[model samples]
Target: MKITPGTRSRATLATVAAAGAALLLLTSCASSTEPAPEAGGAVAEDCTPLHEFPTIQDGVLTVAAMNAAPKFHALSDSGPFTGIDATLIPEFAAENCLEVKFKPMTGAAAQLDLREGKSDMFGGLILKTPERAEVFAQSEGSILYETLGFTSAKDDAYATIDSLKGKRIGTLSGSYYVEPLKAAYGADSIEEYQSDSNAFEDLKAGRIDAVAWQSIQGFNFTDRDEDYVTEILGDEPAYPELTVLLENNWPHTKGNTEMTAAIDDYYERAKADGTVARVLTENKIGAQAADLYVNGR
Candidate 1:
C-alpha cells in the first residue's frame, strides 16, 4: 500500500486495536474452561444427596443388661429390662429415631456380648472400672447413682454386717458386689446368682441372710413388696457408680462415630439446659438428683 501519514496512521491504529482484541479473546477462552471432572466421581453437580445424621429410621440399638433390679431388670414381659437407665436409654435412642432391642445376659456373657457386637451397649448403673475401660466405653457422665447396701426381709434377725459374717449373703456372679462380699466374709462367703431377682428371691426364702445389692432396686423391692424391707448399711464394698457402657471402650470404634456424636450432643444439650437433672428426678433415680455432668465435690 502507498504510505500516507494521516490515512496510514488511522488504519494502523484500528488494525492494532483489532489484533489486541483477538489476543484478549483467545486468552479469555483459554482461562475460562476447566477440564471435565472424572466420570462417576464426586463433582459439584452430581454429588449424592446427604441424609441427615442421628436419623435412625432403620438402625437397631442392641442393649445388653445384667438385670440389676430397679436399676435395670427384666420384670415379667411387661417390665423386662426396664429401669432408670434402661428407660432413659430408649428415650435417647428414640430421640435419634432408632429401634430399641434389649438383650439380658449374665455378667460374663454380657461382657462377651459387648465385645462380639451382639449388643451395642449395656444398661444399668455400672461403675467405670479400669479393667472394663479396656473393653467398653463408659458414659461421660453418670445416668444414675446407686448405693450398694444390704436388704433383709421384714423381721429378719441379721441387722449388722458382722451378724452376717458367717451367714450366707446373696450377690451376682462376676459383679462388683462379689468382691466386697468376698472381702468382708471370705472368698466363698457369697451365694452367687446369675440373676439379681433370683438372688433376692433366695434372700427372701432365708437361703441368704442379707442381699448385698444396689440400693435403688432394694428400695423398689421393699417399696413394692411389704415382705422385703431394705435398710441402708454403712457403705457398700466397691462403691457403686451408675453409667452406660458401650461396646467399644475409650478410643471407641471408628464406625461408631455417628452413635458417639449423637450421645455427646444429647448430653451437651442436657447439661446446658438442665435436662440431665430433670431426667434423673423424673425417674426418681440418682443419689443427689442434680446435674451429673457437673462437678459435685
Candidate 2:
C-alpha cells in the first residue's frame, strides 16, 4: 500500500511544525534576497506553478540532514550549514520561491522526520537502494557515485580481501558494507558503531585494525589526521550511485508532478553545465568516484 502524509495524525504534524520553527530560529540566521547561480550561470526569475507544491510551512523548505562533512551537510558554529547537499538548497529554494530551513537529524531519524512531516526532504549522501526507492523518490541525476574503502592507522598493505582475515574491522551500523565485510571476514571480526566518529575513534585508538566507509569519507579522515590513510577496495565491481531523496507522500510531493519535474530538470542542467563536478572539486571530494561512474571503468 502507498502510504501518504494524510495518514499521519494532526498532533504529529503540529509537533513537527513547532520543532522545525524552533530549529529555524537557531539555525540559518542570515538571509539573502539574491539567488545563487543556477546551471546556466543565471539566477531563477520565476516559480511558475508554485501553487502545486505546498510546503509544510509556507515560503520555506525544511530539510532534515545529518551534520556530516564533505559530501553531506555540515553545521557551522554561527553560520548556515555548508556541504554539497546543503549548498544546493539555496538554488533549489530560489527556483521554488522559498526560503530554506535545516533540521539536524541522523540515519533512520531523518527518514522518520520526513514521514512524520517534520521535514520536507533529507539529503546527506543518501544511497538509492531498491528498498528506499519503493518509498521515496530519488533525484533523477545522481549527485555522485560512492566508492567503498578501508582506513587504517598503520601503513600495512591491504592488497587483498584475505589480508583482513583476522583483523578487527569497524563500520557504521545499518550501512550496506556490514554484510559484505562480515561475509568476507567473519562476523566476529567486525564491529559496528552508531556513527563513523565512533568507528574512527576505535581505529585511532588501535581497538580496530580498519574502518570501512565511503572512500571520500575515508579521505576526509586522512586529510584531518596525518597518521591515517585509506585503501580503495572493490574495484572490479563498482559501488552504487548516491542521490538526494524526496519524501514520496509529503504534502509537497503528493500529486505534485510539476515540482518533481522541475527538480529533475534542475539536476539535469546542473550535471550538463558542470555544476556537480565543480561542487565536488571545490569541496575536494568525489572526483575519483565521479570519474569511475561516468567512464564506466
Candidate 3:
C-alpha cells in the first residue's frame, strides 16, 4: 500500500479500532471455554503454529524502534507511528491476531530491548550485519537497501574517496558509516552528531565540508530544502540491506520459528504485491536505491 502520512494515519486508526473491538469482544466472551478465533475468524493451518510464539505481552507484539524517518519509524504528536516499519508492524500483528505496541528508543537500543526481553523484536530499519547475526535472527528478505553518499551545500561532486582526504566530514553517531568514515578521513577530521539533522545543519553552516549519510536521507534533506545536494559514493551496487531483528535464543526464537517464517512470507507477499515499492515511493524514502536494487535483483 502507498503510505502517505494521511493514509498511514487512517490505516493506523482503523487497525487500532479493529484491535480494540477484538479486545472488547474477547473480554466479553471470557466466560466461555472456547478458544478465541483468529483475526479473520479462521486461521490457516500453516499459520496456526505461529500462535505458539511468545510475545512480550499475552496478545500484544511489543516492538522497540528508533524514530527514524521514511523507511524506519516516524513519530508524530497527533498520529500513530507513520513509517514503513511502523505501518507494517501493526499489519503483521493484526494478521496474527495480536495488538501492536511501539516503544521509541535510540539506535541499537531496539536490539538491546529484544535481548533483554523488554520487547518482542526490533521494529526498525536495522542492517543485517555479521556481528548482529551472531546474536539475532533476521527476518527473510530485506525491507530496504541503503545507498551511501555525501551531502554538501555547494553542490560539489565527490566521486572518489581520495577526494574526501583532509575534508571535514559529518556523520551520525553510532551509524555504520562512522568506522569507514573515520578510517577514510582520519578520526580527527570526522565529527559525529547525535542526529542526521544536526549533521546536515552543520554542513549547511559550513562547519563541515560535507555530511556522510544514506543517499536516501541526503536526498530527502535536499528535496525538502534547496540549499544542499547529494552525490552517491562508492562503486558498489548498494550498501547493506535492512532487516527486522529477533533474539536468536530460545526465549525469543524457539517456538517462534513459524512466527519468523510468517514474517518472511509476508515480506515476500509485500514485495510481490508492490507494497514495499509503493511505500518507498509515496514517502520518497529510498526510491533510487530501491529501483537499483530491484532492477539488479
Candidate 4:
C-alpha cells in the first residue's frame, strides 16, 4: 500500500516534527544550502507523471530500495517499503498525484538497474562521492549523514581505539571496520559476526566490549547514554571510512535531469519548512543536531 503524507495522520506527523525541532543542537551536522525555496506555481492536483514530463512509465515511479536493511529502509521487508526514501519519494509523488512502484534490490543490483535504465531511482542511502557520480545522477537531496565509528558500553572516553586495546571488539563480517579495528587494536581482540544482531548481542551481553559499525546502525541498536560514538575524523590516521561531511544522497538514472530536479525541488521545500526532519523522525531515523540531515549535500 502506498501512503501519502496527506493520507497519513497529520497530528502524528506534527508531533514528530515538533519533537525533531526541539532537539538540542549541541553539534553541527548541516552546512548551509539554498534558502528553502519559493512556493510552486499553480499545479494540477491529479497530475499524470508521463503527461507532465518523460518517465519510464506513466504515473508510476519505479524506485529500487535495498532488500535488506534495518533503517533508512526497513527490516520491515520491501513491500510497501517504509523508511527515509520510502517516505520522501511517496511524499513527492503525492504532491504531484503520482503513484510509486517499490522494488527491492541489493546495492549492486540497484546501481546496475539505474545504469541500465531499469529503475528511475534507488534509495540506497549511498554516500555522495565523486566515484559514484561517474555512474549515476545524484539527486540534490540528503537522506543521511553517515560516519564510521566505535560503540561500547563504556563511558564516552571508551570511544577511542586505545581504550579497546585489550577488550574484545565485535564487527560485522566483511565490514570495512574489521581491518582498521584489527590494525589499531590487535587481530586477537577482534571478532567478526555474520550479522549485526549477533555482534550487538555480544556487545550487550558483555561478551564483547565494543562494536565497530556505522553510526546510523549503531544508533538503531543502542540508546545507552554512556555508549558514545567515536567518529573517524579526517585528521586521524587513515581509517576504513571518514566521518567528515559524508552526506548520503539518493541516486537516479544517469542523465535523468527531470527526475533529479523534481526530487531536488521537493527536498528544498520540505527542508525549508521542516518536513524532511519530521518525516525521517516519523520513520524512526535521527535528523537532528549532530545527526542533522536534509539537502545539506
Candidate 5:
C-alpha cells in the first residue's frame, strides 16, 4: 500500500513532462510568418477551374493568363496578377457583375490549358498567321499591336532581312516568326527555343547571329542587360498583328451567356461613347488612331 501511494507522484511528473513535450511540438509547427504560395503555384481561391460557371453570381470571374514578361506582367509587384489586359479583363468582369481572379501559366501551357478547360481565357496572343484560328477562339478585341524586330549585341551591325540572309536567327518555337522566317529565309536559318530567355542568352554569347522579337520586349531586354541592343528588322511582312483570344463562342461557359453578352455590348458602347479611348489613354497603352477593326487585322 505504501509503495502504491509513492507511485502517484512519479506518474504525475511523467504526465507533466509528456504534456510539456506535446505543447512544444505544437508550438514548433506554428509559423510566425504566414505561408506563401509555392514557387510558380497558382493563387488559391474558391472558384471553379477554366471559364466554367456552376451558377451565375454577381461575383468573381477567374481568368488565367500567360506570365509573358513585361508585356503581360501578370505577376508584377505593382499589381500582382494584374497588368494592362489584366486590368481590362477584371473591369469587363465587373461591368458584368462578376469579380475577377487571375491565374498565371506559361505562354504555351496557357494556350493548351484554356482549350482543356483549365482557364477561362489567356491574353498576349499575337496573330503571326491565320492558322491560330483553328486553336483558341479570338475575342472581338485587339490586345497588343506588336512591332516585330531583330535584337543584337550593341556593337553588332544593324541587319535587315536581306542582310540576315544565310545568318542564324534565334526565335521562340511556334513564334510568329518561326514559320515565316523558315519560308522566306529557309529552314536552316531558323533556330527556335521553347523560351526566348535562353535564346537571348545564347544570342548575347554569340551563339546565334541575331534574335527576333517584339520591339517592346527588346526595350525591356536592354533595360535588364546593358550590352543587349535591338532594332526593327521589319514588320512580320505578311502576318503582323496581335489580338485577344476567347473560348469558342466565348462567354458561352454555362451560366455566363448573359455575362459575356454584357461584355461585348460594353465594348461596343465604349467604342461608340469613347470610354474605351479614355481607358487606353489613362493606361498609357498608346492611342488607337483608327478603328482597330478596319485598320488592323
Candidate 6:
C-alpha cells in the first residue's frame, strides 16, 4: 500500500491522542490509593467496618460528652483527654475500626444530643434505670455500686437521711439522687442544679445545707475543687437504708442495636484484657472499679 500524506497525518493524530490518554490513566491510578477524606466526612464505603455497628456517621463514632467530672473526663472541650473515658473511648473506637469524635455537652443536653442524632454515644455516670432504658440503648452494667454522699461546707457529714428533714438540700436533678433526696427532704424543699459548680456555690454560700453528690465526686470536693466536706452514706453499717446499689452505664442512641452489642462485647473484652483496670488507675479513680465490670453489675 502506498502511504498518503492525509493517512499519515491521521495516524499521527491517533498516536498523540492515545499517548495523552495513557498518561491521564497513569496519573489517576497513582492518586487512587486512600483518597484524602473531606472534613466531617462520616460515610466512606471504602472503610472496613470492624465492629459492624451502624454509626450516625458511618465509620465515625460521635461521643456526646457530659460535663467534665473528676476521673471521667478532662476539663477542656478540645482535650488532652486524660481520663478513663479519654483512654477507653479512643481505644474502643480504634480497635473497633471507628473514628471517634467528641461533642461537649452536659446533663439533659447530652442525652438529647444522642437522641437527636448529633452524636453516637454518651459516656458518663448514668444509672441503668428502666425509664432511661426505654429511651436509650445502653451497655451492660459497667459499674457495680456507686455510693451516695452529702457535701457540706461544715466539717460534719450527715450520717442519716432523717438528719436532713425539711432542710434545703441541692443535688443534680436527673440523677437518682433527686427522688431519694426529695423523699427525705420533701420535693418542695430540695433544689437541683445543672452543674456541680453551682451546687458547690450554693452549699458554700449557706443557701443550702448540703449538696447530695456522687461519692466519686468527693475527688472534686477534697481534691480538684477542694472546699467542702463529703460524708459517704451507703458504706456506713449503721445506715443501710441510705445505701443505693446503682449501676453506671454508657448510653447510646436507641435503635442502634448493632452498636450496642458491639460496645457490650468491647466492655467484656476490655475488662478481661485489663483495659478497664488500667484506665481507671491512669485517671486515679481507683483500680477496683474494675471489679464492677468483673462482677457484671
Question: Which one wins by TM-score: 1 or 5?
Answer: 1
The Cα local distance difference test for each model comes to 0.49, 0.55, 0.55, 0.54, 0.46, 0.58
In the predicted model 4, the residue pairs found to clash are none
Candidate 2 minimal-lDDT segment of 10 residues:
8-17
Q: Write the per-residue lDDT of candidate 2 for residues 194-261, one digit (tens) a residue.
A: 76677888888889998877655666676667677666644433222211111111122334466566
lDDT, residue 228, model 3: 63
Please provide, for model 3 over 25-90, each residue's C-alpha lDDT reduced to its tens digit, 9 standing for 90 to 100: 111111112322223232233343333466767776677766556544443322345556655555
TM-score for each model: 0.62, 0.72, 0.71, 0.62, 0.60, 0.74
Clashes of each: 5, 0, 0, 0, 3, 0
Question: Which stretches in model 2 have alpha-carbon errors above 4 Å?
Answer: 1-52, 76-79, 234-259, 286-290, 293-296
The predictions' CA RMSDs to the true structure, in order, are 28.2, 11.6, 8.7, 11.1, 20.6, 21.5
Which digits, one per residue and each the tens of the lDDT, describe model 1 over residues 36-104? 111111112322212224322235456666565445555432233334455455555544434455566
What is the Cα-based lDDT of residue 108 in candidate 1?
63
Residue 32, candidate 1: alpha-carbon lDDT:
10
The TM-score between candidate 2 and the true structure equals: 0.72
Give me candidate 4's TM-score against the actual structure. Answer: 0.62
Q: How does model 6 score by TM-score?
A: 0.74
Candidate 1 yields a Cα-based lDDT of: 0.49
lDDT tens digits, residue span 159-214, model 6? 56777777888888677678766765689888988877788778878898888866
lDDT of 3 at 108: 57
